[model samples]
Target: MISARNFLHFSRGVALAAAVCFFAATLAVAQTDALPSWNDTAPKQAIISFVEKVTKPDSADFVPEAERIAVFDNDGTLWVEHPIYTQLAFALDRVKSLAPQHPEWKETQPFKAVLEGDMKALAASGEKGLVELIMTTHAGMTTSDFQKIVIDWLASARDPKFKRPYTELVYQPMIELLAYLRANGFKTFIVSGGGVELMRPWAEKVYGIPPEQVVGSSIKTEFRMEDDTPTLFRLPEVNFIDDKAGKPVGINQQIGRRPIAAFGNSDGDLQMLQWTTMAGGPARLGVLIHHTDAAREYAYDRDTEFGRLDKALDAAAITGWTVVDMKADWKQVFKD
Candidate 1:
């Protein structure tokens, strides 16, 4: 028989041990659940099943280390793209910010629309206006300097609809998927049509992908000295446009290897999926994120001003691309 103090100490130790075990078990369960935030759907299930099959050793569908490449489009696929392109919105806002210094912009078409908050005129300018806006606001600065501007803007910029930072506007389900693939030895890359320089500033923090892993549309840049400090300055010339068929070209040029998995939302990403499938690799998967949740997010197809999804819709069934309906599949959208 032990003394009363010894008995009490032993009981306390036992309780602590039980508590630790319980906590650990709870944590393990939570972590397991974290990756499957999306509701049961063929696309979500397929994603999980593919990752498990490829990553598990001794599995018939096990993908080798060199071949475990997964690529994702950035804009509409990974985050929200509505009420006009968010990056374009950022560029317009930057144009407004600089209008005070560049008084000539007050009289210019796109710049005038930006300064006066004239959406009608802005839309009327169309792609040419958009190109001019991007060229004027995003270029003529060192890469590092532009990156800092992007970082600053994203930190302060809030989505007009959600009232959240642009960074926080990312899809919760996709983020989990990114983490899940990375955990299973898949090298996740952001093969976006958005500007490479724009995405580089925050992709690592937001998507867990480094700048090198992000391949996208690029503008010309030249090395120059400002105040005797040598830096790379962005030139107002398009080097590449990583959209539609350009997606595959950019991927091939940059990665030099076909990705085993491709995820995208719009027709801009259709060529990427095509390339992934047509390349003829083992156990390839192509997924398209269909925006169907109107309340949680704006939903439009074919007629939408930004990220039109018409062609991709028709191709989904014929090509076997899994179209994920956001309203049905996602248990949650933006992170709380």
Candidate 2:
């Protein structure tokens, strides 16, 4: 007969194995708690419940992979948008770099202000100044040339306030949520007010959203040939402004069908969430990422010079969109 001591040793081995299994299971659950990071509000529950119902093969609410459309705004929603928009800074930097070539820019109203580092004067010019800055530096070149310039600049560009790569400054929670949704068969797209071409050049590398999946503000362009060389040059004109009401129009123009899910963080995205949720769907979801932590990320609304969030807040309540308080919802904002 086996000794009682040997039997006890076998029992101890089995107990240790069971303990390891239990610990492993707990770790797995913790890692998969992406939705748990969200608040317990009705809007948050709606998203979690919908995702569960759709992913279950036996459920009547199961949505096919092709029908899962998720759209996200880029600025305040996906990354930081305080003090100023990153693209505007990009345009200003471009003005400074290209100013030497175009000496007339020294006399130009907005470009001259940007060159002289007179932000107060630039803002006083208001919308007219903002538009002039975008047009002068963003346009007037081949799309390929513009793309190359953005790529090269981004390599060295760091957020002036945070001192991190503008790309690295993206919200960590959103990045995790994006990957989780994609793993469950959701196709993600970025619908931002920023220039489409500007986003397309680096979005695939940064966010994993291919150029074809991006929809944003765009300028008009024409295909042409210059002495046996084919080229596509940007026009000094506006094609569409993908903000507020324009967001829905741009989505319809590009994505065709209404998205079942949408995310935004400002008045610029109010119409986008409205369109996403009001499209006669039983399982549509909308989320808004609110910047509330002034210490971690700058916070301002309505009267703020950039990324005014007041109108969007009103719409959030009316439309039942999930407004994620940055201070409460996310444990960390950036990788840094």
Candidate 3:
């Protein structure tokens, strides 16, 4: 018969083995889970199917790694864009901070609207007023100085609705999707309508996309030498608008290769989707993220002022694009 001490030693060995097996199993699950934050719904399945179709060398839809480009919209698609855009919030805050220097701003329509926390008045100011605000606050500075200003603002600014830093408000499912694509050898680019310089300041740290790969609206800049140091000075005039139809134009000028996949959330992205999936040789993927979860995240479409999802909503059905119901497809919203 085995001694009691020998039996105890045997039990210890078994327990250690069980612990190691559990750890191995947990690691295996993690490695296999491409989009853990996404529910195992039709949208998730479609994403996996497309990735597999394009990446599989044996498949007819196989696309080379160099041509497997995927473009994503920044504002609503990657992160939160509700109540007001993050950039607009920054502009409003800048107006308030600069109010002491420009006492006349207190009487100015758009600046006054921002100072008094009057969102309705700000909205009434229209595109022209918005442009004025952007130009006044964003221009007349070196590009490097502007980037530093942006980075500093984002560090202190919190989303009013979430009471969290704007960077922390990125969708968990989308983050996972970006990683999954990168792991599969796809080069992802952010073709947002937001300001390119504004995004380049923090996009790499936040989204793993480098500066040169980002494309967006920009203002004119002049090359100059100040204090024997070369600097690019931002001009108040608009150079390019990367929204709606301009998205396609931006893609053509910035990224010469047509993307095999495109992801976006609003009507601003409609032309982008059309440009990406249409006139395609291999199977192209165009997916739209519909904000349908009200309790977890704001739910508004066709009627919302920001990130409006009207025409794109109707086109998804007609064009056979996969429209993700955020409430159903996303298991989690923000990255807790």
Model 2 agreement with the true structure over 135-215: per-residue lDDT tens digits: 888889999999999999888988989988788888887887787789789999999999998889888888889999999
Question: Which residue pairs show collisions in model 2?
Answer: none
Writing each residue's lDDT as its tens digit, candidate 1 over 1-336 gives: 999999999999999999999999999867776456699878777887877787778888788877899999998888888876788879978987887899898888988988999989988999899899999888887899898998899888888888888888899999999998887788999998889988888899999999899999999999888799898989999999999999999999999999989999888988999988766645678999988889989787788878899998899889888899888889898888
Q: Which stretches of candidate 3 lie over 4 Å from their true place?
A: 1-31
**What's the TM for model 2?**
0.87
Tell me the spans in candidate 1 whose CA falls farther than 4 Å from its real position. Answer: 1-31, 225-228
Model 2 stretches astray by more than 4 angstroms:
1-31, 34-46
Score residue 156 of candidate 1 by CA lDDT: 88
Which one wins by lDDT: 1 or 2?
1
- Among residues 3 or more apart in sequence or in different chains, the pairs in candidate 3 whose N, CA or C atoms overlap within 3 Å are none
lDDT of 2 at 122: 88
* Top-lDDT candidate index: 3
* Model 3, global lDDT: 0.93
Deviation from native of the Cα of residue 253 in model 1, angstroms: 1.5
- Model 3, 1-336: lDDT tens per residue? 879999999999999999999999899867899898999999999999999999999999999899989999999999999988888998998998889999998899999999998888988999999999999999999999999999999999999999999999999999999999999999999999999998998889989999998999999999999889999999999999999999999999999988889999999999999999888578899999999999999898899889999999999999889999999999899877
Candidate 2 lDDT trough over 10 residues, lowest sum: 35-44
TM-score of 1: 0.88
lDDT-based ranking = 3, 1, 2
| Candidate 1: C-alpha lDDT | 0.88
